[model samples]
Each structure stands twice: as C-alpha cells, then as structure tokens.
Target chain A: MSLDKEKIKHVAKLARISVDEAKVDSLTKDLNSIFKFIEQLNELNTDKVEPLTSILNQSLRSRKDEISDGKIREKILKNSPKKNEEFFVVPKVVE
Target chain B: MSNITNQSLSEILKSIKSKKISSLELTQEYIKNIENAKKLNAFVTTTFDKALENAKKFDNKPNNEQLLSGIPLAVKDLFCTENVKTTAGSNILNNFVPSYESTVTKNLWNNGAFLLGKLNCDEFAMGSSNETSFFGNVINPIGDHLVPGGSSGGSSSALAADLTPATIGTDTGGSIRQPASFTGTVGLKPTYGLCSRWGIVAFASSLDQAGPMTKTVNDCSIMLEAMSGFDDKDSTSINKKKESYSKNLKDNIKGLKIGIPKEYRVDNMPKEIDELWEKGKKILKDLGAQLIDISLPHTKYALPTYYIVAPAEASSNLARYDGVRYGYRSQKGKDLIEMYENTRSEGFGDEVKRRILIGTYVLSSGYYDAYYLKAQKVRQLIKKDFDDSFTKVDAILTPSTPSSAFKIGEKTNDPVSMYLNDIFTVPVNLAGLPALSLPAGLDKQGYPLGLQLIGKALDEQKILNIGYAFEKNCGYKNEIKKWWS
Candidate 1:
C-alpha cells in the first residue's frame, strides 16, 4: 500500500497534473492510506455479484451525432485568455 | 413583507397573478430578505440587477404565463449562470463567470423563473457539510451549530430560513437530500437526465441530477414541471418524451405498495432514526398503503461502490480546471506547465485536493481494473437489488442520512466519516434512480428527520405522489422556523 514518490509522479503524469517534489510525499501518503481502506473490498464475497452502471438498467440515451450545435463563435471566445476573430491561439504545439 | 416566510413558489406566483403584489415588489422583498439573512451565508453572489431587469420583463410581456415569473429562487453556485460568477465554492474558479447559462437555468429562464442569487456550497460540490466552501460556512438556521448539510448547503439553509420561496440544488451522492433532511426542506434528485446537465459544473455526470429544493411537495412539483425538459445539447437528456412532474402530485396513494428494505436496518443504527421509521410505517399503513418487508442484499456494498465510481468520474470531470483554459492561474510559476500545476495546487482547498488525489488513484492505469471497473460492477449489483424490489412495490422507503446533521468540523477531517454521510442515498445514484427527501418528523434531539422515497426510473411522479400523500397524511406542523427567530 505504500505509494512511493515515483508512483505519485507516475499517476500525476497520467492525470496531466505536475506534482511538485515537496508535495509528492504528502500526496503519496494520502493516496496510500486511501488505497489501504479501498483494499477492504477484496475480502467481501463478490464472486456472484454483478457490476452496475445504472440502477434502472437502461441504456444511456444519446442524440444524433451530427454537427448541429449552434454557432456561438463570439460566446465561445468570450472567456478565452487568448483569442482572435476566427479561432483561439495558444503556444504553438509544433514548428 | 418581512414575514413572507414559508410561502411556496405557487403562493408567490399567485400573488403576482392576482395583482396583489407586483413581481418587482416580490423580487425586492426577497432581495431585502437575502440581505437581512446575512448570518446564514446562504448566498455566494446575488444577481441583483439581472433579477430586477428580468422581473421588469415580466411586466412588459403581458401574455407570458410561465409558472415562476416574479418568484425569486436561489441557484446553487454549481450551476452556470450567464454573467454571474460561478464560484463552484472553489477559489480556483473565484473569478470564473460563465459566458453561458446551464440548460436547466436556460429552461427555467425560458419559463420566466427569475434568479435571486448564487448560494454557497462546498468546494466543487465535494463536501456534505458546506464547510469546505471557499465563501465560508453556511450556518444552519436550526441553530445547534449543526452543519447545513452541503455542497447544496446554502440552498437548503436559505429555504429553511425562508430567504427565498425555493432554490435549485443539485444532488450528487446526497448533497441535496442530506442538506434538505438536515434543514427540513423538500429536496429531490430526479432520475438521471431528468434535468439537462449542459451548464451544470460536473461532479459525477452519471449520478448528478438537479431538482427543486422547496418548502412543500406541491412547490417541488411546480418547479420540477418548469425545470424538467429534454435538451438537444445534453446527450444524456431523457428523450422518450417529456412528462409533467406536477401532474400526479394529487394522485391517491391508497393501495400503493411501499417496500421497506430489511438490509437498511443495520445493527445498532441511531435510535432516533430507527424509531422514526417505525412511526412513518404506521402513518403510511393508516393511509391505506401496504408496507411490505423486502431485502436489498447489495446494500452493504453501495457506499464503497459509490466512493469508487463517483471519485473516478469526478477525477475526470475536474481535469478541465487546469489554469490554462479557465479558473485561477498562478502568477508564480516559472513555465507554462508549472503555472498550471502551481495554480491548481494552490487554488484548490485541502479536501478538494484529497478527493482529486483519490480520484486519480482509482482511475489510474495500473489500478483502474481493480478499483474503477470493480466499483462499476458492484454498481450493477446495487441496481439489481432495487430492480428486484421494485417488481413487487411501487417505491422503496429509507432514511435520508444515517442521522441528523453533525456539528461543523465534527468529522470534516475524517474523510471516511464524511463519506459515510451518503451511505443511504448513494445507492440511488449508483442505480440512477430518482429519490426525494420529505420531512417525516423531528428526531428525539428536536432536529428535523427526513424519510426518503426512491422511485423507479422516470417514476418521479410516483415518488412525488407518495411524498404528497405523506405530507397530507401528517397534519405535521413544519416547526423549525422558531430557530431562525
């Protein structure tokens, strides 16, 4: 149940968060304790149990997958940190 | 004007119709009430100009007949309101004002529901005690220093304090119901997708549903009627056909069969709640309803399953808050990535950081199968328990929370103890069932007690009918207003 600093950094990378070296030990300690509590599930007799996504057992409803969203170019850029008339700009990802 | 307390949204709307009071007058009075009830910390930010302007719109549009035109309601800060700062009870989004309103708010606005102000809540709607909110703790009007049960704590306390006729609160796990139970107001978490989620700040998308938090079942019906609708923007919005939530409020519950789950009678439960269940059963029986003992064997795993699934989804849902796109940006970072990390690290509070860490762990690559997948499977077993029971009964009755509201800071540090608060209500979210908390009676300690009636999917009316019947059956006085005095 001991999550090392490396393990914490590993998880943080996958979660897109950058964990500081100083805080890694603290998050590691907390995550390990939580996992320790969570490990209790192995003792339960869940051999015959079926996992569920919804209580009513209905499939999720979905709309037609088409580009029908109303155009809100101005509204979309209203809160953007950096935006031009046609699109949002960020630090260039590639040359 | 000061005593416009305990009036339902229907009563306020009626006064507007009869010309007994202008919508502007009603809005101003509640605005004054919100100002006076400052001790409750119920409001995060008030949309004063927007509300008055909207009320004036009602005056000009004589043909408009929306149910809540002039009536003011406190929107839980979790929902995005255009031009209003949606703090989400987090400092990370301290200055984050949404450019668009959530579909639920949009629908309400289309029907002429005026906004009062944003209510305070736990950070990112994470805690059940409202204490984690960056805006500060919302005091329960119950006055025992009891936490107004949270995330939606502000909405519940405001309703209890009569600051507004009603408030819109979201229930993810038991955020709405626990607070409603603690404060003795009517709150509901409708079947998933009953209200559109396009604008709501995500907690757990699969389980989060918004419904009315009100003073009576009838007001809930009216509010729900206005709020519940299918929206194209929300992929999961119910599409079978829209149903009026208020239509069946007056339906007779005679011969209605209610299932009481034996699994819920855990060993050494709070005596106050256990006794209240017995008394509630007697009341239902006397109303000519049959109470059948039932078993939902999967009840034991519900809490564990909910913790895993909700946190997993929450982990994914919260990823959007990195300082780059929106929310708080740290000024101290040396680089772009460092800036995002440091901003989130400093902006999010301790409890939120803890949950984010747990959420990350559960959904991590090495542990996803063992933790996240297994939790989803247990989720199915939990649903099956209710499905099997509903075959023989119309709805299931259970306690809202394990006990009454705890004193603030009592279990805030103990994460497990805090998670245990949603033990009873979490199962409904796992099953995606609709559940409502209605006032049953006072606990021995004189704090309010809530009885939960869970209904089948799209069976919101059935729960509403049962709640209405319970309210009718008890000439029970809604006594707790004395605390505010």
Candidate 2:
C-alpha cells in the first residue's frame, strides 16, 4: 500500500506534472495514506454489479452531423498562451 | 445595514416587480456590501460596473419575462461567463477569460439575473475547505476564524454575509451542500443532468452538479427553477421540461415516507450534529411524516469510491490544461513534454496536483482495473443501495455535515481529515440524486447546524416540500453580526 518516490514520480510524469524532488517524499506519504484508505473498497462483494456510468440511464443524443459551434476562431484563439494567426504555437515536435 | 440584503429571493423579486424598490437601487446596495466586505475574501472578481449598467437597463423598463431581472447574484468562479474571467479558483486559469457562457448561467441571465461578481472556491472544486483557492481562503461570515466550507465556499460566504442576495455553486461531492451547511444557508445539488454542465469547469464530470445557494429553501427552489433546463449542448441533460418548483412548494409532507439511513451514524460525530438529526426527525414526525429505518450498506465505501471515481474523471477532464492552449504557460521548459510538465506543475496548486497524481496512478496501465474499474463497480452498488431504499421511502434525512464550521487552517495539513467533512453528503452525488442542506438549529456555540434531505432521482419536489415543512419550525436564522471589516 505504500507508494515510493519512484512510483510517485512515474504518476507525476503520466499526469504531465513535475513534482519537486523535496516534495516527492511527502507526496508519496500522502498518496499511500489515501490509497490505504481507499483499500477498504476491496472488502465489498461487488460481483454482479454493473458499472454505473450515467445516473439517468439516458442514451446519448445525436444531432445532424453539421458544424454547430466552430465559427468563432478569433474568440476561441484569444485565450491561447502562444498562438499565430490560426494555430497554437508549441515547441517543434518533428526532429 | 440595509434590510434589503436580509430579505428572501421571493421578497426581492416581488419588490422589484412591484416597483417598490428599483432594481438599480437594490443592485447598488449589494454593490456597496460587496465592496465593503473584502476582508472575507469571498469574491475573486466583482462586476460592479457591469452590474450597475445592467441594473440601469432593467430599471428603465422592467422586464417581466425574466425572473431574475435586476437581481444581483454572485456566480461561483467555476461557471464560465463570456468576456469575464472564470478561473475555477486556480492559478492556471487566472487570466483565462471564457468566450462562451455556461448554460446554467446563461439560463439565469436570460431569466433576468445579473451578476455581482465571480466568487472564490477551492481550486477546480476539489477541497472541502476554501483554503485551497489560489485567491486565498474564504473566511466564514459567521465566525471570523472559521472557514466557509468549499469548493463553493465563496458562494456560501457571500450569501451569509449579505454581500449578494443569492449565489450559484457547483457540487461534485458536497461542494454546494457542505458549504451551505457550514454557512447556515440553503444549497441544493439538483439531480445530475437537471442543470446543464455545459461550460462549468469540469471536476468529475459525472458527479458535478450546479445548484443554488440561497437564504431560504424557497429561494433555492426559485433559483433552481431558473437555472435548470435541458440543453442540447450537454450530452447528459435530461430532455424533460423544467418543473415549476417554486409554485409547487407545498408545506405538506403528511403521510410521506422518510427514511433515516442507519449507515450515516458514524463514530465520534459531534453531539450537536446527532442532536440536530434527532431534532430533524422529530420535526418531520411532528408533520405526520412516516420515518422508517433504512440502510445504505455501501455507505462506508462511498468516500473511497468517490475519491477514485471523481479524481479519475477529473484527471481526464483536466487534461486540456497543457501549455499550448489557454491559461498559464511556463517558460522554464526547453522542450514540448518538459513544457507541459512545467506548465502544469507551475499552474496547479498543491491539492490539485495531488489529486491529478492520484488520478494518474489509479488510471495507469496496471492499476486501472484494480482502482478505476473496481471503483466503478462499487459505484453501481452504492447507487443500487439508494435505488432500493427509495422504493420504501420518499426521501432520506441526515446531518448535512458532521459538525459546524471549523476554524480556518485547522485541517489544512491533513487532507484526509478535510475529506471526511463530506461523508454524509457525497453518497447522494455518487448516486446522482437530488439533495439539499438546510439550517436545522444552532449549536451551543451559536454556529448553525444543518441537516440534509436526500431525494430520489428527479424527486426534488418531495425534498423541497419536506424541507419547507421542516424550515417552518427550525427557527434558524443566519443573522450573525458582521465580524469582518
């Protein structure tokens, strides 16, 4: 049930976050304690239950496959941290 | 102090419509109160200029078409407001001005409600106390040293302090109700899909619900009626017509079956909370309600299951916050992947980062089945418990929170202790049922204690009726003197 620094670091990586080296021990401790607490669910007998995704059991509603929203590119792109005329600027991915 | 702030939502609406009080005057009074109460740290953004302009427009020619016309209300920072900053109480979104409005807030605006400002909350609606907000902790209006329960802490505090007539809050797991309970105000988490979650900041999408935080149950009903309607934008929105809850507020629960879930009795619960439950039961019994002993056996697993399910959903939902898109971007990274990591690490607060990490761990390759899938299955069991119980009882009653408001920074170091504050309230969210917290009585310290009424799916009317009957006798008022300068 104990999470080590390596595991914590791995999770931070997967989550696209960077934890400070000094804080990893404390984060590991917190994660372990939380995992230990949630381990109580292991005691339940949930053999026949189906995973409840949505409470209202409503089927997904579909509409005509036409563009409904993407008309405001200027408004949408205004929030970008780094943007050109029509694209969000990120570091080059291709080598 | 202007008595206008003390009036109920219905009273204010009536006065506005009757021209007894101009919407501009009423709005100005709220603006003054909001301006004067900065010590509470309840508001993250104040739309005073916009509110005044909107009030003038409404006063020129009052519109009966909108229910909230000229009504000054605060929105929790989670809901998106076009051209206004919607931070969701996080530094990542500190400068993020949304282009579109949330459907619920849009519905309110369409019905005549004007915004006082955006209120503070726990970052991404994660924490039990408002301390996790990047804007700083929202102080409880009732007690200077106490915290306004969160992640809708600012909503509750604003209402309690009379800074605004009413406010809107979101509840993923007791975000709305717990804060309402702590502040001695009324907050209802309507049935999931009742209100559109279209533009509200996502935190556990399946569990997040937007509801009203108000001075009275009647106000909560009125506000909810205005805020809820099926939106084609939200995939899960129920296609049913909105119900007129305010018109249907009948104070008669006679012969109605009320269930007292035995599983809610936890060890070391505050004596006042237990007494409040007993008192609540007695009040319902006095109103001729049939109180029955019921059991939700999976109650103990609700918190753990919620921790897994909510964070799992949050982890997925919050993935949109990379450096490339909107919000904060870090300059420390030299490469793309490093940029994403650094941006997220710099943007999100500690509590938010912890949840993201926990979420990532649970949903990781080897642990997905053990954590996420298992939690989903247990979630079904938890829902089944409520489903079976509803067949026998019309509604369930329990203590809203285990105790009244605790002093600020009391449980900041221990996240688990903070999480326990929502023990009695989270099950309803996991099951996607309607629930409300109403002030039941005052504890010995004069702080208010609240009791929750959990209703079956889409059965908000029954819950409101029971709450209405109980409120008549509770005699609780959040008329605490302003301790904050």
Candidate 3:
C-alpha cells in the first residue's frame, strides 16, 4: 500500500496539483505512512455491512424545479480571479 | 467597566439588557482586547470598523429581546462572511471576499450578534493543530509556545483570550472540542445537520458541523440555540422544531444513566487525563446520575476511517478551486489544465495538498473499493456502536483529547501523531451525534484537560445539561493569566 514517487505523481496529476520534483520524495514518504495507517481498516470484516452514504435515514428532499432567483450575473462574477462582462475568463481552453 | 471583557455571554447580555453596558461600549472593550493581544496571532482579519459601526447601530436602536442582542463575536475564518475576507486560513482565498453570507453566520447576525473579526484556523479546517494555518500559528493564550488546538484554534484562542465574548467553530473531527479542551473553554458539536453548511468553504461535507465555543457550558447552550435551525438551502439540515436549549437546560441529571466507554482508554494515556476522567465520573455520580461501563467496540478504527472518508470527500469538494472562479491563480501556467495544477499546488498549503492527494488516491479507480468503500462500511460500524450504546445509557463520558495542548513544532513532521489528537472526539462526529467538551481540570503543567459528554443524535440538550451540572460541581476554573498582554 506504500506510494512510490511515480504513484505520487500520478495521484497528484489526478488531483490537478503539480508536485515539485524536490518534494516528491518526502511526499511519497508521508503518503506511505498515512496509507500504512489506513491499512488498519482492512482488519475489520464488513462483507455484509452497508456503506454509509448519509447519516440521516431519510431520502433527499426535492424542491420545485423552477427559476428561483436570477438577474445577479454581476454579483456572481464579482469574486472571479479573472472575469469579463458576464462570464469567468479562464486560460484558452480551445486553441 | 474595565473587567467587562471578562464576563460571559450571558452576563454581557444581562448588562446590555439592564442598560449597564451599551453594545457600543462592549464592542469597544473587545476591540481593545484584540488590539492589545495581537501577539497571540489569533485573528486573521479584524473587522473593528465594521464591528464598531454595527455596534453603534445596535446601540442607537437597542433590541434586548433578541438572543444575542448586539453581542460581537469573532468566528473562525472558515465561515464565509459576506463582503468580508473569508480565507479559511489558506493562501488560495487570501483575496477572496464572499459575495453571500453563509447560512450559519447569517443566522448569528440575525440573532443580533455582529462580526468582531474573522479568526484564524487550520487551512480549510484540515489540521488538528493551528500550525497548518497559512495565516500563521495561533499561540494558545495559556502559554507562550503552546499550539492552540485547531482547526477552530482561532475561535478557541479568541474566546479563551476574551477577544470575543463567545465564538463559533466548525468541527469536522475535533476542530471545536479539541481546541476547546486545550484552551479551557466550552465547545459543543451539535448533531450533524443541526446547523446548515451553506456557503461554508467545503472541507468534508458530511462531517463538517458548526457549533459554539464559549467560556461556559451555559453560553454554549445559548449560542447553539441561536446558531442551529432548518435551512432550505442545505438539504441535510434537520427540519425538526428548534428546542429551547437555554430555557430547558436543567443542571439536575438525577436518575439519568451515563455511559463510561471502556474502550476510550487508549494505551499510554496520560495519568492525569485518566484521573480527570475518574473525577468526572465521581462528580456525575455525586450528582445522582447512574454511571454504567459500556463498550463502543469499533472505537479504535474511527481515526483510520475518518482519514479515508474526510480526504476522499475533500478532494472532490476542493476540485471547485480550479483557478477559474475565485481564489489564487498561478502565473506560471500556459494552458487551462496547467493553470489548475499550478494554482492548486501554489495556492494550497502542504497539509491541505497532502489531504487532497490522499483523497484523490483513495477515490481513484483501482483503490476505491479497498479504501473509500471499506472506510464507509467501517463508518457504519462506528455509528452502530454508538447507537447500540445509547440504547443502554442516556449519554457517554470520555476524555476530550488524549493529552493537553502540545508545544508548537513538536508533531508537525509526523502527520499520524497529529491525527491522534482527535481520537476521543472523532467518534462523535462519525455517529452524527452531539458532544460537548467541558474544561474539567488541568494537567501537571497547568495545561487544561477536558471531559466530553457524548449524546444521541439531536440530543444536545441532554449533554449540555449534564455539562452544566458537571460545571457546577467540578470546581475547575481556568486560571489563564493574560500572559500575552
């Protein structure tokens, strides 16, 4: 269950976080120790146990699917790091 | 008037109602305390001007009937305060001011409490100690070098230091109670879904709950009553009728059955913590409550389960911070994907990055069943253990933490050691139950130790009542000598 440098890089990639080369070794070590700690869960037999998706036993409540609130486009875009007129401006996605 | 800052929330409320201390005067006193105690590094953003404005407004049109009635509170930075900086103690959100108020903070404001400031916390409410905060470590006011237990470190520190009359904090694991234990304050994590999570910076959605951190258990009850309610915005919020916890609070727990879980005695536990637990039992017994020894057999696996579940959810929740919306953006990236990678890497601190990575790994394709699913099943067993125990006893008692506050930099390098700080407190969160940490005694070094009272789901009143009775009989007073001043 120990993570190596390659696995650490792969996971970091999936998480969309870039790992520095200098930090990879220590990161790998820390992840391995944490994984080692998590491995203790394997000792419990949960074959028939149900995975707890929610603490409350009730079903998710639904609301009427209608336009509730709108016309605050400027407020929605106010916190964007980079935005223009009506939308968030990201780096060029389709070059 | 000089010692006005030293009064509890209830006492201040009484004075304000009697016209003895105006809201403006109270706010000014707290602002002065916060200014003079800046060495503790408890506050990330101080709202002294806005606080003063609100205080003046409240004083001009006083409303004594409201719950808080113009009390100023400094909440943990994890809560999103509208038009104010809500960093969650991370560099990623250093400049991000939320456009909307979180439902919890909104509730607090509606009840007549205004923001004094945003207190520092572990980044994204991720770490057990305040050391993980990007703003910097909040020194426990009890001593110069002790780490304030976190991610509610700032809330606990501010409350203990009298920077705020009372404060609120979110507990994912032990964020509220552990710090409360360390700082010798009262903290209650109400039943999961008791408080709405809308607009809070997402950590682990299921386990993250907002609760009160106050100077006394009575204050905890009053604050919790104000802070919790059904919200249409949060799907998980309980829609049950709000109970008057403060009004119904009774210090007489005679004939009530309290459980003492034998499994909480972990190996190498401090001798004083054990003595403190024994003393708590004796106090409860003397108060006419029946104490029974019970077993929550799956208690040992709670931490490991929490590590897997919390991080897995965190990775998914934090994926929202892709540099497209708000928060820190890296200048190094050339393309969209690279921009996200660089932004997350540079924006988040190391501990946050570590949790995100662990979350991403466990929820990844090949490992999902072995780690994430398995942990969820273990989580069910953990919850069931509490359910089984609650059927036999009204509430359970345990030590709030394994030890008192540790010195800063002592366990920073070892993540596992740091995770152990929440051992006693994490189980309550997993079961979606309510628990309160009451400052019962101090360690040999004069560091505060707390005893926890665990209750069934939505049973905050019972635990708070027990805590009230314990507070009356325990004879423990926090002798925090304003060393920072």
In TM-score terms, which candidate is top?
3
Query: Candidates sorted by TM-score, descending order?
Result: 3, 2, 1
For candidate 1, lDDT tens digit of each residue in B367-475? 8878887887777777878889999999888988888888988986577778778878888888888999988888777788899999998898888988898888765
lDDT of 3 by residue, A12-62 (tens): 999999999999988888889998998999899999999999998777799
Q: Which residue pairs clash within candidate 3? A: none
RMSD of 2: 1.0
What is each candidate's DockQ, to 2 decimals? 0.41, 0.84, 0.89
List the candidate 1 regions with Cα displacement exceeding 4 Å. Answer: A2-6, A16-33, A45-66, A69-73, A81-95, B62-64, B481-485
Computed on alpha carbons, the lDDT of every model, listed in order, comes to 0.81, 0.91, 0.93
Against the true structure, whose DockQ is highest?
3
Local error of candidate 1 at B218, Å?
0.6
Weakest lDDT window of 10 consecutive positions for candidate 3 chain A: A1-10
- Interface root mean square deviation of every model, in Å? 2.6, 0.9, 0.8
- Tens-digit lDDT track for model 2 on B170-250? 999999999999889999999999999999999998999999999888988889899999999999999997799989999
lDDT of 1: 0.81
Off by over 4 Å in 2: none
Q: Any runs in candidate 3 off by more than 4 Å, and if so which?
A: none
Model 2 Cα shift for residue B130 (angstroms): 0.5
lDDT of 3 by residue, B1-485 (tens): 89998888999999999999999999999999999999999999999999999999999999988999989999999889989999999999999998899999999999999999999999999988899999899999999999889999999899989999999999999899999999999999999999999988989999999999999888998999999999999999989998899999899999999999999999999999999999999999999999999999999999999999999999999999987788899988889999999999999999999999999999999899999999999999999999999899999999999999999999999999999999999988888999999999999999999999999998899999999999999998887899878
